[model samples]
Target: MSEILRKGDIGQAVADLQADLRRAGYAVERTAIYDNGTRDAVAALQGATGLVVDGAYGPKSRAALANFDVSRLMRESDLIAAADRLGVPLASIKAVNEVESRGRGFLADGRPVILYERHVFWKQLVAHGVDPAAYAERTAILSRQRGGYAGGAAEYVRLASAMQIHAAAAQEAASWGAFQVMGYHWKALGFADIESFVATQYRSEGDQLATFTAFVLADTTLHRALKARKWAQFARLYNGPAYAENLYDTKLARAYARFAGEESEAVA
Candidate 1:
């Protein structure tokens, strides 16, 4: 009871923590050891309960579990449905999910994940009838050069400021949810508009999967590459031309193997 369990701590205490987390309907494994999954679940619980989200099982985290609810954030059925919708193996979806989101749709504070793109914001300002040159100096939120990222919930600060300048364009400029689809793709992704797309984002991870599947299905090249397991082709379409430099395709192949239970040609 005196020890604080973290990402590497192991033993009966860790196992108990896993059980309690699972009981609360978090997507955690009872592996008898504290790992990333356990830490993320703990962090989510802390965020939901207004405790400091340090991904550690401390005294406060222990106390919060006593009043926890079994409000699961996602379900197995959702994954199957998404894969079915795409006519691909569940592993394909899972591989992309893991690669893009590290298997988390929401952040520590129960907000859907987002990344504010300065370059996208720069373009968005122009689309919204604002002078990009005037706000180009606000490089953190609006700029032609793509390099300012606050990461995690902190990115919302950037988004908020951009919203003040141009609300619709600001929202369109950011990537959202587990699949990290850019808001600009709302119409083509089947959403009525950016607000509709954003609304679904705040709903649940299941909805996020829907957005991802829609994105994949909408693009013939992307869908073909994913179904064929052509990692490099899919990576280029999804992550941009610099995907190889980031080893995104390599990661996709390896991640797909982990979920698909098959060896990757790239790896083996």
Candidate 2:
């Protein structure tokens, strides 16, 4: 028998589920109020899976959330627009998105970008322990590798907030939108950077999401080190020798290849 997991505050949960479903390219209205269609979707899902087809949100329903595909949720136009704003290659963006979230939904483990304890040592040397300044240097290095930088301060905001390295500061990103870039940073990127035809206006929320996507793609630094085939350098770039060893285990190439495989199949 189908069960209602909990009551009263089910609105928020249902809304979140609906949003995720829509993001994964399902048909869910954004009214934040779940009605019959939403219920039927839930019931149909249950029926297809041989579960009790009661039109209710429950534990089994929650578990099924993992099966929804995210690639369908985002519009292709939005994906293209976002890629241009971040100044990343569209293929790279598609690859990373496919591997990271399977085009399913927004990132699950949002965190502040930070170096691990051992990596903290190198970061001190490379980034100088000044939060903003360190990020600035990291940005410069990445810009040179990526061929150009477009997002400006707004890009930094997303990196500082959602990237795993900065997990501690993710809460500061509460007011931020989809890509989690602060509005101010979004605004600043507009005037600071000269955008061409392909580039969207920096302050655009759509652009912000794309910029954050680019940031995540670039963070791995696997692309750069792979070209050089410098194990130590790649290790330093990702974290540090120890952290990289644990993180990558087998080898940098192997781990990167794994991630690449995941990226290749991601939906827009």
Candidate 3:
């Protein structure tokens, strides 16, 4: 591994490097292949720890990762783009981001915050041609009923296990990043597949917001709900039928009001 590792490289060396970066709190996955996610994480590490922002792995990055504020993943421009894409107010977009992820994506460890639902995984695997009865014993990670939320970075543990059974299915079952956009929406969001959708999560909050915008634009009803300030409808469409029980609609409305007020004042 004396050579500098860049995108398009592969092998145990790459995986090892990813492991080293992950331990240092970078979002590089241990996929044994150097993809764009790895490159971005490397570049982030480089810029954060004062190395050149080359997006390549070499001696400097290796030593720097163990030490780390990554470059900004989200920006005001991202929110504006999302609002423009949805034909809604920027306040609306900001409100959703705040409600879904407290206004930013990623964990303190630099990994995207994921919520891998067991029931979704169960159905996804079955749909992908893997029988759940084969090991119903592992209900924690595979269940018809959802409830084992480890939350935040720990959710990746459940994801890693399910990935072993079926990579694409596993990824599609989870809600990812700032907006918690489900990977199942990958195709409609314009990605080639779930793998690509999940990779973008590792990119930045802005990337996640872009996916969310795609999702809203594709679902006309959802888009209209947000545009009309129909918080209840938007919440139900976005978060499922039981949204009222969690007051997601209320939270969204309040957050929107706060941002709208601020934006209005700025205009004045």
Q: Which candidate wins on TM-score?
A: 1
RMSD score of candidate 3 (Å):
13.9
Q: Compute the lDDT of residue 116 as modeled in candidate 2.
A: 18
Task: Compose the digit string of candidate 3's lDDT tens values, residues 1-268.
Answer: 8467978999999999989878878787899999988987887776666543446676446556655243435555677778887888888887887676544467877788788988998898888898987868888788989888897778999999988888888898898887888888898889998888888988887788888888889999989999999999999998888999999999999988977875676589
Give the range where candidate 1 is weakest over 10 consecutive residues by summed lDDT: 258-267
The TM-scores of all predictions, comma-separated, are: 0.72, 0.26, 0.70
Cα lDDT listed for each candidate: 0.80, 0.42, 0.80
- A best-first ranking of the candidates according to their TM-score comes to 1, 3, 2
Q: Which stretches of candidate 2 lie over 4 Å from their true place?
A: 1-72, 83-89, 101-188, 191-208, 213-268
> Which order, best to worst by lDDT?
1, 3, 2
